[model samples]
Target chain A: MRFLTLVLRSLFRSKRRTFLTVLSLSVSVFLIALLQSLLGTMDALTTSTGSGTRFVVQDKASFTNVIPQAYTNFLRQQPEVERFTVLQWFGGEYKDPKNFFANFGVDPESYLQVYREEANLPSIPLEQVRDFLRDGNGCMVGRALADKFGWKVGDVVPLKSSIFNLTVRLNIRIIFAGLRKSDEMVLAFNIKQLQEAVPWMKGRVGAITVRAKNPADIPRLCERIDHHFANSAQETLSITENAFNLNMMKLLGDYSTMVHSISAAVLVAILIVTANTMAMAIRERTTQISTMRALGFRSGQILSLLMAEGLLLSLLGSGLGIALAMGVASAAAKVAGQIIPWMADFIITPETLLLCVLITLALGLLSTFIPAYRASRRPITEGLRAL
Target chain B: MDDVSVRLRNLAKSYWRGSLEIPVLTGIDLEIPRGGYYALMGPSGSGKTTLLNLIAGIDRPSGGELEVCGHSLNGLNDDELAGWRSRNVGFIFQNYNLVPVLNAYENVELPLLLQDLGRAERRERVLHALSLVNLTDRMRNYPRQLSGGQEQRVAIARAIVHDPELIVADEPTGALDAKNAEEALILLEHLNQELGKTIVLVTHDPKAASHARFQIHLEKGVLDRTVEVHDRPVLPRLLT
Candidate 1:
């Protein structure tokens, strides 16, 4: 504890150098934090608890290809399947191309039953559900989507569909909130209205969501469902909801590998910069180190002091970097939520913070070990003669 | 133990310049009794500083039986020697060698920190040592803020704060002006006589050498002779 002040004072002997090194380190750490958080957010979608019991059945060729709506009857007859719904990606633009959110055409009744845990609408009265089921043009919007467009109950929302080249208008009957922030970025309408309106989409859907009676039955059921449709004209692929979301992320093209590679690169760059800075600082203190040795301070003690300085410098820089990363992550969540609705809950998790701290500590030790050891191990006479 | 602070017999040191072995000290024999004050005077490259460093246990002798404060330095490893030096020897350098980042008090507190002393006890000893050097008022001033003499005095305080049995000073006042040099010499004399410290000083200045009770001269890495100074009177009694 007594040596702390000495180490700190020595570290700042060249204030400009120390400050610049710290600034560079902080910037690198901030970038690493962001990259790691991005990966963590993507991973969250695949690991979500609500996705455990759900399965997605899509065309075996590709998820983009539509599967027959007739497959729903076969899926409902399976004992492992409890309830299921048709979910068609509307791919609709609100007012402008930039104003985009996930708008899905779903069976209003079964959609609510399968996603009850994900979409929290406990406060919604039964009258709204009845109105949504009875009225063919009725729809339900999440609170976030409603707030975004100043939409209220009975407000007619006009959506321009890019896929079908059709304009669909529907009256909102329910403004729902969700158990999680990401869930509130969706707009679900009755698929019957879409089917009646579009001639080609009449007997097909983008995907079918099957809720398994038991989460443990998912693997077997998915395999069974895929085998059932293997010989059909339009073969089907059935996967756990988590795997489905992962496949969706795969469309963004190996982003996990890209983010991790960029993160590793950032770490290596900061390590070199920090190591160089530490080397320069230790070099300048060669004479002082010798004097301390002559004063009966052991080489190990001197080495520890230098290491402590490096560690402290890194921790300080990382602390500021963590704060900056959190602020930027919050802003990014808001902006990214508009473009990628599922990413509305993106955040820098505590696990990433812990991981970053460990990385910083390792970096500190790695960066300082060779230089500090070399400086400490030099003969006392040689060090004394330096300068 | 021969009641001596430092004892050497046939002590020799050499340096290797690439493949060549260059002898610095050869066939040196010396003894300075406990509480004795001695000055080593020699020309440049005469190995006086090298001898001082060896005596302080900061450098190892190439060959010899070297003992300071009753510890045989030859058998001790580097870490053992460091521990022995911390407990038994204090050092003052020509450049004042006080850590530039530390103020006088903190600098004086350095050696004591190597001990098992508590913070309060260390503080008390540091203050007392600074007081002995008459630099207590300047304890908070860093080495850069001090004049040459004041810095040397701070260095002296640092050297004695641990109350080591021996003090090895290499040209203690070499960087000081005449007035400061005289003050430093007086402080050394007081430390040797009043506090019963054994001081081994290496210097080129005749006036600085005059403050010691005896002088040893080194020539070409060999002990030339020893001279006893009769002009000054020893103190009547040890201060403590």
Candidate 2:
């Protein structure tokens, strides 16, 4: 109990310096936790949601290359194919290029039939969906996009295309009838309207989102779909929805590895900076440390004192730093939501909080090691001479 | 060797600078009688502090037989020596080495911590020690808050708190002015006369040396003269 007073008083000797050290450490931890929260987005696209009953038909070569949409009609005639729909990526930006939202072209009625996740749109009137999507220029917007542009049911929005090379005017239809307005990036527009607008886009789509009667028959159904288009002008690639998402992910080229490299670099830099600050603190307290030893504190006690001091300061610093980082992340979330939607939900949880504390402790311990050993081993005579 | 508190046979301490073995206290034999006030006066490098350190068990002799209070110092390990010293020897230095972090009472209570005394018993002992030097009123005063004389008195209180049989003071009055020095000498003399403590004081001041019943002078690394001043009882010795 009495020894703890020694540790506490020692910390207060340099109020400003100690406060700064603790603050820096806290900020560093917050940044790291933010990155960890971002990791929540990593999902095995096709393998995720684990509905092996779903199958896809696309170009095995890549998502950038299209597969024949005529294949979906042929697949529907097959015995194992219960339902199928073509999903197309409409790379369109609204108002300005920076105010972009994910615009995917999918079959209006049949798309809902294949995906139960998007099946609740009927609660909103069909007349409401039609009034907005009446013309070829008219298209429905996702709830995420609707919220972003402040779009109402009757408002018409203009969007420039990156892939099809045209300005697309889409109407704000019934906002996606789901709880996840954040998943608006995944919302779909009318495929027939998109196809009629682009004549050259005939019998072509990015991929097919299919569901088979029996999950075990997915391989057989996929083989049948490929066999019919074998060596044809528009041959098809058949796969599970998970495999389809995996193939899409390959375009990004090992995203997890890249994130890991970035995170590792950040962790190392934080360790070095925090350790340096603790070293300076220990160096400044050389005389006091020696006096403590002469007063009968053993080497281990001195080590504990320094360790406790460093840890406390770093935890405080990094805690403040994390708070700052969280503020920065919150500010960034608004801008990110313009493109990504609901990005603020990516938060630092309690596990992440503990990880931050451990990081501060590790850095503090590593930094205090040399100074504590030096101070603990210093001869009393030499230390007294310094005074 | 009668009434001997310490017995040293050919005590030698050598320092090695690089390849050279420079001997400090070579082939020295000394005996200190129990319950007597004595001063060891010596010039620089005369080994007075070193000799005092050896007798107090603060440092070990390189080649010697050192026996204090019937226990051989040469054979005792560091922990055993520390324990034995706490039980029998108390040390006071020129700087009044009272732990600055602790107050006067706590400073006196330090050595008592090593003893098996409980907190209440330790408190009583510390208070009694503080009252001995008339510093009970200043019990809560830290080293910085107390005067040099008061600090030295607190230090004396600390040394005697454990009731050690022998008290070794190295340059006790070396840092004090004439007035404080006289006052400190009187307190040391009072401990010698009233409590009959065996005191080994190493100092250069003649005034401080005059208070001790026996004074030994050293030059170089050896004792040159031994002077005795009798502070005997007024009445003849009784067979109590």
> lDDT for every model?
0.89, 0.72
Report the lDDT tens digits of candidate 2 across residue range B116-146: 7888999999998888888999998888999
Q: Write the per-residue lDDT of candidate 2 for residues A77-115, one digit (tens) a residue.
A: 888877787888888777678776667788765665676
Candidate number achieving the greatest TM-score relative to the actual structure? 1
Residue pairs clashing, model 1 = none
lDDT of 2: 0.72
Per-candidate clashes come to 0, 16
Report per-prediction Cα RMSD to one decimal: 2.8, 6.2
Q: Cα deviation of B12 in candidate 1 (Å)?
A: 2.2
Error of 2 at A63 (Å): 3.4
Score candidate 2 by DockQ: 0.15
- At residue B88, give the lDDT of candidate 2: 83
